[model samples]
Target: MITKILPGTNIELKSGARDADLSVTGVVAMALPLHWGGRVTVIHAGDNTLYPLGYKISDPALKLVREVMNGAKQLILYRLNTVGAKASAEVSTGVTAEAVFPGTRGNDLSVVVSASGEKWLVKTYFGTQEVDSQIISAAADFSPYYVALSGTGTLAAATVKLTGGTDGAVESDYTGFFAELEKREYNVICSTDSDRAADVVSFVKEQNANRAYVQGVVTGVHPDSEAIYVCNSTGGVTADYELTPAESCATLAGLIAQAGVQTSLTYHRGITGWTDVKPHLTIDQQTGRTQNGEVLFVPLYGSPSVLYDITSLTTFDEDHPKDFGKGLVMRTLQKYQSDLQKLLDTRCVGKIRNSVEGRAQIKAMVFEMTSRGYLAPGYMEDFSADDITVTAGTERDAVSVVVGIKAVDTVDKIYVTVTAL
Candidate 1:
């Protein structure tokens, strides 16, 4: 159970409950928020110059460069797609337009879009963009753009300061949105008898429109969050899902992630199984319920989230990974059994490994505390104590330590070896 998400919404359909549809209408408001680290002063005032670090957009990123041209405000829609992964993907977003009502937290923006054409309203967003509404003012000859705004200030609010950026970067999500829409429409109607991808696509459509099915996609996706993200990928695409969702995108993302993975995930409300899917893992109901039975969900943007490192770190190499953390327990217990006395004796010396997945920079350190307990495999206490600095000779008071050696595949494990003193 990856319960890292903050309190929001948890929706699940019973095994066969309400085979009904919930066709949604226009978009009311969509939000995509990224939390910042606590503010800290970086420097003391020198000649009255106080230096501190603050989050700011760079000239290269998609979000920072897509502000509306009319005024300083960012357009809720645009005619172009700019930035993001180089390899383009076609995505479909159901919501088209939205509305905004002044409430407590600044005037909230609502989007109005069609959900199976019922005209739905969404006051919340997963990762939807405001650019979906930027239509060319004049259709045939490419004139100006018409964005809904009553007052001159509304347009004035659209102006953006010219931070050096390329004009070629039109708007974020534009390409993805259009590509997605075109693909989905084609998939729905294309007469391919064997391609069940259409069935899945149709299922998403029903989820949003009628009371029988729900349709959506994952947006603002990242390793830690499970929220589903949907995109229109059209000119300045529109969306309903975000990395942090107020609703179902979480479930949707989990499913997408699970479908593409070897392990499965279960919850109090529903169960997500990677069944009939490519390279999936199954529930180990026979040999007792174990997280080690499947995949190991690693966390990004933070501390170590791998539970059973000692064995999982070694057993599952790179390609043949034991999926979805189903095998977490077994892998973890194997380690615990090896050092039970040390684990139970709190005062004993213990060590852990540190790795930078893509970089392949592997390191380890000794620890003294258990900061958090998220898996059957224990976590380090005083978490930061992990992968401590090891220096040569007199660099950091080097101490002689005994080391245990073993091969990843060979069963003849464990041998005493000497380390830096």
Candidate 2:
């Protein structure tokens, strides 16, 4: 059954079970940086903090929505008390020691089962910003005892000798080892050091072109590596079905854009293979997706455009009227084809007021304005959640706008078209 995160309530997280029980600890569906409306539902769980008020499962098709690793550190409780409970007696966690995970894009969820045939489903989060299939894209070796190694072909350079445990066939050749990789039924995280990441890119590109390759966004991307790193974005020059050349990264700005009125969205990255991985920032809600037209990413410091859409922590209460900013921010970092707000700030004839409640409120306000064309550059309409002071002679506060993160009964997916410069 699907778990629901009701609007307008603050709840702490505990632990949960995979099948019928979810621990008392609220399950975190997606990571942080997620924007929710009053009715948004959660698909994952996490340790106690504040979970949007949650409800129990009633649907079976969505039962396995979140990945459940067999040996990961999750809990196995039947349920918890008031979702907002701050009590410790109602919490528990799994102590298994295996590398299994699950990840999801939209409703598409998959798990990373280990070489030991352990199954998993990482709890995923959908952020206010858009997520792409791209990531750090570095692969390393998982030696005996979950050992980590570097450099490509290292498995070929050495023999893996297993003592006290059942060992399978060993390959002394790198090519042979990798070929065996494709044949293995389990999702094995194998890696070897390489002087340049270019070779890694070549290997991925040679593997497939139609389908975007999976880069290790989390595992091993860093600067000052004693080992080499490479850029592997090269591929056939076919135009991105959803993007144009003008929308490509002009600097360190990577982007994920929408192309149709409401397009199908997906997330792909190496988060699944992270396996008790290292230092990484957790952003974006695990199961939440953005309004159809929203874009999300990090931007250059001096970017002439708006980056970082802060839509987390919005409160959506039904009895209370929530003035939601239809569309406010873009989540992706890149050279944007359309600066939805910049166009509004200067073009619209209303004074910009910070009437929103929180960091997330501002984003909610902006989004609300954009969706109704009040925030568009060409329009002069005003929006409001509440009546406010006008600078003496300024245009009467159009609509005293207030925003919260409750999904509209008739929410629409957003999209944008890319044009090559």
Candidate 3:
């Protein structure tokens, strides 16, 4: 008899040493009218053709992008100006020079064609800065950013400043945009349109009825809407663009993504977006709004940064007097589903047989998750080896695995009792 070491055994030993890494699930999607970038279509982070957003306030495209990015790992921007009017070009008589894309920002652009010795000089100006300048004998070498050259006009030493450029009408194509967004996965989606935001929540529920739950954070239409809409009743108007309710929620989404899987947003100070939440809501009002499934930034002593994390979940939370309606719980559930799916799909699928050995592997991974604080330690005993059932499903080509998970929740409130002697 000889002792044999199997290749599979070696692989198992190596994999067992490493635990499953927690996945980040905070991708955001929104639609906006962007100037000079995107062809009235959907653009993702990897699209190099899309114009990049800058940190400058004058750049509306970049400003909006930065606003959403303040709370998301990545953003999927859809330029919603397909049927809308394009900004009229400030034509210099015979030239086809026009602002790229349709928007009001084109009004700021001006083009100047001058003669510099032999080569004709074409310069585009946005305010005092000369954005584009090119020396070309023909219109073929025109700058793409500022103007598109046209006509067979002969070269001349003359300058004409563009005029009569109008920002064309632009509208959000919510139906088309949402349909496209359905094909991908994102954690938080923020919208200022109340009707669209409500529809988003419905879509999220429908998609997550079986699995993959995503939360939609929207600006409330009113103070009494039953949704995860936030309010900024701050008395003073500050210049921070992030002070807007929608942007604030986007920031909160980012915070939740970076936070622990089992944490709550209660008392977690909002990021550097808002200076203060004013009009100091009474305790009763705050409680009522939360009961109606609305979130608000509360003023606490010197800071108005406290974000009360409440979900727009109305039906189930009312029946159960727990923190089930809290955004933290939804996030924890997302983490649990995402991590478990990853564990099963990557490690358990096809690698191990559906037998006692496979069941053991599943238990090991679950135990590891518990050890890492992703799952509650005290609930480990509930995750029995026998609890994991890998069996053939109703479909011939399908295998279903059923496993129980206990997610740890954050402590939001504390009550103390004092007895006087």
Alpha-carbon RMSD, candidate 3: 6.2
Q: Which stretches of model 1 miss by more than 4 angstroms?
A: 1-252, 255-421
TM-score of each: 0.20, 0.16, 0.74
lDDT digits (tens) for residues 1-421 of candidate 1: 2454688877755564211221111111111211211111111112111001112221112221111110111111112322311111111121121111111111122223233222222122212333234322111212211112222111111221111122133232223333333322111111011122233344434433432211233222211111112211111111311211212222222332222212212221122211111111133331121222212222222221211211112234464344312222322222222333233223222322222321121112122211122121222112342333332334332332332221122122258898989
Better of 2 and 3 by TM-score: 3
After superposition, the stretches of candidate 3 with alpha carbons farther than 4 Å from their true spots are 1-24, 33-66, 88-94, 114-121, 154-173, 210-212, 221-237, 240-263, 317-323, 342-387, 394-396, 418-421
lDDT of 3 by residue, 158-275 (tens): 5445444433445544776677777766666566555566566666566566565565666654332222434333221234433455545554555554453545667766444456
- Candidate 2 residue 56 Cα shift, in angstroms, is 54
* Predicted structure 1, TM vs. truth: 0.20
By descending lDDT, how would the candidates be arranged?
3, 2, 1
- The residue-by-residue lDDT of candidate 2 on 1-421, one tens digit each, is 3455886656667775212211112111111111111112222334331123211122221112112211112212111111111111100121111211111111221112122223221121222222112111222323211211234331111112111111122222234323433432111111222232234334434432322212111112222111111111211111111111111111101111111112111221221212221111124421232221122221123222212222221344663222221222111100111233233344333544433333234444356444453224323234344322212223434433223222211223368899999
Query: Least accurate stretch of 10 residues (summed lDDT) in model 1?
Result: 185-194
Of 1 and 2, the candidate ahead on lDDT is 2
